[model samples]
Each structure stands twice: as structure tokens, then as C-alpha cells.
Target: MECDASTIVSGFVEKVVSRYAESIDRDNVAPPEFFRDAAGHGVFGLPIPREYGGWGLPFSDFMDALRLIARESPSIAHIIFVHSMSAYFVEKFGSEEAREEILPGAARGERILALAFTEPGAGSDLASIETRAEKRGDTYVLEGEKLFTTNALYADTFIVLARTGPLEARHKALTLFALDKAEGVEVGEPLDLMGFRGTGLARVLLKGVEVPSSRVLGRENEGFKPAVVGLGVGRLPFASIALGIAEGALEEAVRWALERKSFGRPIFENQAVSFPLAEVAAEVEAVKALIRRTAELHDKGENILLHASIAKFLAARLAVKATRIAVQVMGGRGLLTASKVSRLYRDAKAAEIAEGTNEVQLMIIARDLAKRVR
Candidate 1:
């Protein structure tokens, strides 16, 4: 039976959204209690199978949950999104032993996982990563540094991609390892970035980290395929998060516009103000539709790489525009740190950078289009 996306998860998400938003900004870290609450409520395991103690809900329901979380705290949503995406990868591709060992705890919110893909030498070019993993008996000795790893500080395990074969092989040479944060795994100091501050992004240094054979995800040298597939599915949640940020900014802008007076009249009454607000509203709705459609395409098992990239790119771009307009609408108060629009503005930029940058997405789309023409 298909899960009821709208009905089942909305209420739970609404109850926690505002609280998460407030604490996430104040703490500058994902509120540990919030994740525990979500896990207890079956949100962390939204996509995991019931056998693994997850709800195993349909992808639509997962999107709804993500939207709610994003509305409240985009950083928390982002952290959860990355971890859940990793969990999904493990559940889908990892061996039975791996699944049984990790899935239940992760689904229950007892564990957090991070994706370690971006390297100092390679950002958009995954094939250019210089991180190496050499087989040493039954274990792989890993050595490399991964940058911009979301949730690295909090993650108990990481899905690390390293070059397992000759560098010339590029995509075919890479392999994935489900590495634990043990002695050799060094999580660098948390980065203080301009946005998504609570996500705990950090540089991960893997120096001779020994991962057992059982820790390998999928077969050796076949990591790129699953990594790409996981990224495609992951983009939908990011698009939803962007939509939520834009919507939140819009709501704040409207509230401020209606209440704040200029020239002895409410600012919203001005055609100049109202027209831009209307434009933002329309753009937000369009983004929502795009995110939903892309998610549906993913659920249908269609090849949605181009569509995912499009949705992610457009949603991120629109979010930046909408949030900027929101700030403009609110004038001085919008620039204040305490203002909702202000936070939204910061969060909106992350959408453009995470999952994949807008530039990278455009390149992917253009490449796909060129192939079709050929």
C-alpha cells in the first residue's frame, strides 16, 4: 500500500519545526534531543524497511517530513538529510551483515552517518579525488582528506569513497568504505561557515584508517555508480529544503510587509512591495511543484539525473532570489540576526552549494542534453 504522505507526517513535523529552528540557530549544532525525538517518532527511519525498525514510508512521505524539518531548521534538515541518504545507501547496497548491524540503530536515531565524498583536490569532479585505499590483507588502508563533510563531527560512521585502483581509471577506480570513526580517522575542527552552521561540516582526515572487508559498500571499484545513484535520490530532499526556506522567508516577508508601516501606511499596500511579494510567492509555488515532480520521478524509478539536477538548481536559485526579496521587503529589521528572514537568507545560500553546486548541476544538465542531441 502506498503511504499517505500528507496525512501521516505533517502534524508531527509542525510540532517540532519552530523549536528546532530556534535551538538550531542558538546552539550552532544540530540539537541532539531533536534527532532523538524524531527517531523515537519514526522519522529518522522514514525510508528504512519495517524489518529494520523503520517506517519504510513512501518517498512522498519522506519529502513531507523533510519539508517540515526544513521549515523549522534547514540545518537540522540538512544534517538529517545527509545521514538518512547514507543510511538509504547502506540499506540498499550493503551486505546483510552490514544492514543488520547498522540499519536498526541508524533508523532508531542511535547512530549517525556522513557521506565523505568531497576532497580538497576534488569538489565537483568526483573522479579527481586523490584519496587512496589500498588493500592490506582483509582490510583496506585508507589515506586522504575529505572536505565539507556534513555531520562529520557527530557521525559515528562514514560512507567514504576512495581511489581503489589506478588513478587513470577515474570513476572505475573508486570504491566505497563504511568506515567507523576509530583511531586513525581524524575529524578536524568544525568549520564556522556563513550558513548551515549547525550541520557540523568539517574536514575528515583518514590516515591509515583500516576498514575491514565487510565494511566495503558494494563491490570494490563499483562505488561511483551507487554514489551517483544515492546523490540523485538525495537531491529531492535538498530541493524540498530549499522550497521550505523560500516559503519561510516569504511568510516572514508577508507578515512584516503587512504590519510594518511606511509613509503612514503598511508597506504591503504599496504596489512596489506587493508586486515583488507576489512574484516571490509565485516563484516559490513553482519551485514546490518542481521539487514534487522530481521526487515523483525518482519514486517511479525513472532516470531522473537531469530532472533532479534541474529541480535542485532552480529551487536553489529561486530560494536565493526569494530570500533576498524578503529581506528587501522587511527593510532594516530583516538584516538583524534575530530576524527569520535573515536566517533564511543565510540558509538559502547553502542550497546553492550543497548536494551539488548550481554550476555543477548546470554542467550535468548540459551534458545530458548534448548526449540526447547526438
Candidate 2:
């Protein structure tokens, strides 16, 4: 079946894909003009309600759009994903005031939102976070540090998770706030990373930052549920991004293979290079199927946590392998800085680390299996 938003997304890809890559690798930033074009094209609001200036498309369409963007620049796609995902959470769980304050700006792409869940001490163990949000009469005084927050420096808003009660409460005491980086919030310098260099990942410090009570998202002490649900929704898009990266790598490898000659014949004629390319193609297709199936489960309102984890884990592993093999197929040309395959190889590593690490996804799946057994 034809997808609803694919045609619009194709236009976006055609216009902005090459620009995204140039800005990401050379400028180390997403160009403002590129974001302006995306906003004008109704991309930022794909999942939000039409009343809120969004397209009101389903998650599947959203996933497709993200994949298309990711094919050109994963970092730009990462920025878009975080903002759209934050909008989704606010629409579902935020109070009326919170929604009204954030959704419109998000829809307009005027507000960029980032998630602040990871801490220096709590990498994947979210319950161990020490960021505290002490309640005052009509506000919360937040004091803590968040690490590895994507778009932190550039974001206008943050969905910050902070400890609200006793240590034993852990997950139960966790609360989420829709915080603006106005007064007490401080963002550190951006991280110079191995890949996804364009994403403004930074350390955020909230020093007695006062957030209005209305900024609380969802019910007090009930943040974990929406957080986990948001992750389930996010995984499919991340998998799609991985698929795009692999496809890009494969395309580059094929082009190089056809042009590069060895033994008086094109490299494509060699069994060794051709075999790996074929295998990579098959792996990408298989992962695409897995992503589609998981997306279907989500659309059907079925429990998708297990399937989401499976898709994420499989896609991440395959992306790394496929990109590596593509690089190998292109030989020395692939290792050159100017080669697109070289960029894909780096982007693939970032894909494995983002959303959730491959190791983390596997553990989540294993835990679900254990619960089923019990």
C-alpha cells in the first residue's frame, strides 16, 4: 500500500538531503535555512493535531519521513525525532496548560525540546538518577545535572526527569517537568563526538531552577509510564534511521564497485565484493521488514514493547555490519574522508548508540521473555 506522506517526504529529501549532509559534516551544525524549509513543509508537526498546526499523520508516516531525512543526515533526523517525540508526549500526558504552552511552538518548529534523563551517575539505570526537584509552594526547585542531552544547547525546552521523593521510591518518585532554559539552567559546551557531530549534545545543569507547577507533565510520580511508552514509539523511527544509513552505504558501495577496476575487470565482477554487497542488501531488507512489522503492531494498538525492542536490536546490529561491509567493498576509496561510505560508516556507529544501545535493547527483550516464562 502507498504511504500517505511519502510523496511530501520525497520532495523534502530531494530538496534538503544533500544540504543536510554538507552542513552536518562540514559546518558541524544544522543550517537554519534547512530547518526553516522543514518547518514550512509541515515536517515538524507530522504527528501533532491539525488544530495545533500539525499534519495529524499516523506514526507510520512519521517514521517514513524520519527515514528519508536520515538517509541524508542522521544528525538532523535526530533533532527532528527528539522534538516530535516530545510533542507526542505532551499531547498524550501533559496537563492542558502544559500542552497549550508547548504544542503550538513545537508545531511551528519554534521550540526545540530535548530529553534530560541521563545523568553522570545514571547512564542506563534511570532509577538511579540523583537530580532532585524539591517542591515549594507553587513551584519546583530543580538542582541536578543531565549528561549527553542531545540538542541541549539549542533547545528552548527540556523534558527533565528528577527525583521527587525518598531513595526507595526510585522510579515511583520520578517526576517530569517541561522546563524552559531561562534563568537557573546552564548548558555546557557541546561534545565533540565520534559521529553525529552536528547534534548539540551537551551537559545541562539545573541549579535551583524554578519551574511553575503547571509545567509538570503527566501525573506527579507517574513519569516513568509515559517515558517508557515514548521510548517504544521512538524505537521504530530509530530502526528506520538505521535502515536508511545502511541503504546509503550500500548505494555508495555499488557505485564505487562499478567504477573501480581490479584484474582488468570492475570490482563488481569479483565474487568476494559482490557477495558481501548482496548479503548487506538482504540484511537491510530483512531489517526493513522487521521495522514495518513493529510499526504495524504499534498502529494496531497492540502491546509493542517486545517487538520494538526486537526491531531496534536487530536493526542496530545489521546497520553496523552492513556499513562495515560496504566500506570493505569499496576498499581504500571507502576509507577516504570524501567518500560517502566513510560518512555512513561513522553514522552507523551513532545509530547503534542512540535511542537505546543495542545491549540495552537486548536486555529489555530478555526481561520480557523471562516474564513470559514466569
Candidate 3:
């Protein structure tokens, strides 16, 4: 029997994933120990099938687990989000042999995976990527640089996108390959960003990296569908991270307002402070409903591109708004780098840009919306 959608992953999330919430965010380097601990507790195994040594919870349950992780540390949650893109692509398109080889170690956290697609010139555009792969007798040699790889610094393997056909072929020329970082692959230092710090974010330089034919994730030159599916799956959890940020911001702001007294009474008593909190609270709830609904649709195998974009777009914007409000309520104290409010503020902005930028999401939504209207 399949696992129930609820209660399957609560314990590990509550006990193990939340344990390093403070330290994970505070440390400059992401602690490898946290990944090991999370793996030992079976957090990584939740999404894998039972046949492959995983608990095999429903996708909705996986999304719910991500929400808990996000509440603790969206940085960690963001890392998992990128990993999901790799995991999903491998599971859906990789050979049975490859799945058997990769999924078990992945479930155990012995192996970490990341996707390398974006480049300096190609942020939202996938077809224009300059990375190219040349097919030889039995291997495909790849060479190029990928920017903004969330787990590149420590990932054991990368599912990279490279041009296999021709630039004139546009997106159809793109192919996905799961290549080991062992040979010909160089991982660069993490980018100094405003948020999602310590995610092992870095540039990946692939110089003549050779991939065995078997490591190709999907049909050669036909990876566009898988890439789109990965993005769709990603939007659900990415939105959840934004949701957690909004919720955490609301919690922090409310506490700060209720305690920090003003001229006559608590700051919360002042409409100037209280009104924004109330407004943000209402908005967060709306985003929460949409997020949950989106996840449920995803679990049902429904086409969720439009819904996912709506959720992500709203969640990112709302999270940033709420975090800013939290900082406002906390005043000077919120500006401190050490404060959770400050962290939330920074992470909220990052949410809008990662996965796909808010602008990209809007473009997708507008295009889809036009179809429905016509």
C-alpha cells in the first residue's frame, strides 16, 4: 500500500531538520553534518519510492515536509528545491539501472545532486545557453560555464544542460546529462548574495567533461519536456519556502510589536504598526491556501504550470512584503544581521529571483492567461 499523504514525514522534519535551524543560517559555510543528519533521519528518502529504500510519501506530503524545512531555514529548503529538479529528472527519465544506482545513495544522502542550466547570458532563457556537448564514439564531451548552481560546490553529480544540436534549433537543441564532477568539471566559489547564503551556490565550469552515453538523463536533444516538468515540480516547493518566510516574518513581527512598548502602550496597540501586520497576515493566509491547493493539484498529477506560477509569484512578493513589515515593526533591532527578521527580509527577496525570476513567472502567467481569455 502507498503511504498516507499526512503524518509520514512529520517526526524527522520536527526533530532532525529543525535541529540546526539557527546554526545553518549563522554559519558561513553550509555544514555537511546537517545533510548527513537529515539523511540518517530519512528526510531525503521521503520523496523516493519504497522499492528504492525510501518511504515513498505522496508529492503533497513532500511539499508539506518542505514547508517545515523552509520555516526553519529557507536556505536549506532552497538547496533541496534545486536537488529536486535533479531527482525528478533522473527518476522520470533515467534508465532503470541508473535509477537503481543513483536513487538509493541519494535517499541515504550519500550522494548529492544539482542542476546546472543557467549561464551568465541565459538567466530565464534556456535555449540561448552557450554550453555545448559533442557526441563521440561512446561519450559526450561538454564544455562551458554555468552560473547560479545552488548545490554546485558540494554536489556529487550534476544534471547539466548543453547544446547538442544547433543554436538555430533553439530549445530543441538542448540535452540533459547527469555527469560526475570527478573529471573535467570545476566547481567555483559561492556567489556573495543577499539571501540563501551558504547554499553551496557557485559557478560550474565544465571543460571537456565527458559523459558516458548511459548518463544521459533523457532522449538526446529532447530534454525540453523534462526540464519543463522539473521547473513545474520546483515551483511548488519554492513557493513553500516563500510561504514559510512570510509566516515566520509575521510571527516575528507580531511578537516584536506586542512586546516592544511605545510612547503609551505596546507598539502593537498603534494602528501604524498593527495595520500592516494585519494586512500581511491576511495576505499570508491567501498565499498559504493557494500553496496548499497547488501542492494538492501537483500530487493529483494535474497540469499545474499556471497554478504553480501563481503560487510562486504571489508567495515571493508577499514574503518580501511581510519580511519588510516585520523589520519595520522591530525598527532598529530588525536591521541587525543577527536578527531573524533581517534574515527573513533578505531571503524573501531571494525567493523572487530564484527558480525563475518574478518577471519570468509573470510572463508565463500572462501568456497562459491570454490563452484562457481567448
Q: Mark the regions of model 3 whose C-alpha exceeds 4 Å error after superposition.
A: 1-19
**Model 2 pairs in collision:** none
Model 1 CA lDDT for position 7: 51
Off by over 4 Å in 1: 1-15
For each candidate in turn, give its C-alpha RMSD to the true structure in angstroms.
1.9, 2.1, 2.0
Cα misplacement distance, residue 57 of candidate 1 (Å): 2.0
Instruction: Write candidate 1's Cα lDDT for 199-293 as tens digits.
Output: 87999999889888898999999999999888976887888888888887888889889999979999999999999889988988787787777
Q: Between prediction 1 and prediction 2, which has the larger TM-score?
A: 2
Top candidate, metric TM-score: 2
TM-score of each: 0.94, 0.95, 0.94
Off by over 4 Å in 2: 1-4
Q: Model 1, clash count?
A: 0
Residue range 268-319, candidate 3, lDDT tens digits: 9999999999999899888888878877887887988888888899999998
Residue pairs with backbone atoms closer than 3 Å in model 1 (clashes): none
